[model samples]
Target: MDKDKSIDHQLRATWQAVAKMYNEQAANYGSTMAMAFVLLTIDKENGTPSTALGPLMGMEPTSLSRILKSMEDKGAISREKNPEDGRSVIIKLTAYGLEMRKFSKSHVYQFNNVVREYVTEKELDSFFKVTSTINKLIADKEIYNAISQDK
Candidate 1:
């Protein structure tokens, strides 16, 4: 089978391209794509629990720790002891972080608008359906069990 016809190949290639473009654009604001993504995931008003951040953003603890530290050093976020949970910390956006988040939000909106301009609503619906099916398959462990059965 041709690699170009593979769904995994197409998905991986498309995502890599998207990440590169986003990182390039983020560089203009003195940020990286990951930083921008973390900023956007944070709640503007209320703080998010440090433990929940990893799962929420699908980031590894080590990687997220580095990003959080860098953001703190840059005055983008503040970590405070959780009032409700003594064992946990809350990640809050600094005033400057809110400003950066606004830009991140705008960038996301611009990307969506550009995609909408090129793709029809019907096409987006179909794309969503495919992605949803893929996610369901993974969540149900169909792919994992399928390979295990052949062993």
Candidate 2:
């Protein structure tokens, strides 16, 4: 099949481009896109549980651990024992982290604003609906399961 005609190819290519753009922007702040994502995922007022962060970001534990360590080294985040769950730790953003979060948020907003300028609201709504349906199909295992069951 031609890559240009493949749905997955389009999705992957667009995401790669978006990631590259974000990474370039993050480099200006001496950070990576992953770190910026974590900064955004974390709650500002109440720290998020370390365990929850992985699932929230759809990231693997090992990768998240490395990112967390780097953020800690940079004083962007601090870990504290979760009061509600003594077994788990909570990840809280320090003052510097909060500032970084703001910067991350602004970049995100700018990206969306630029996209909105080019795309109509109706087009964006359709794009979101299509993506949501794609996610649901994958999450429900309806794609491969159907093929395997037919065999």
Clashing pairs in 2: none
Candidate 1 is scored at a TM of 0.95
Candidate 2, residue 150: the lDDT equals 98
Candidate 2 lDDT over 1-151, as tens digits, reads: 9999999999999999999999999999989999999999999989899999999999999999999999999999999999988999999999999999999999999999999999999999999999999999999999999999999
CA displacement after TM-score superposition, residue 35 of candidate 1 (Å) = 0.9
| lDDT on C-alpha atoms for all candidate structures | 0.93, 0.98
Model 1 clash pairs are none
Best by TM-score: 2
> What are the runs in model 2 whose C-alpha is more than 4 Å off?
none
Worst 10-residue lDDT window, candidate 2: 79-88
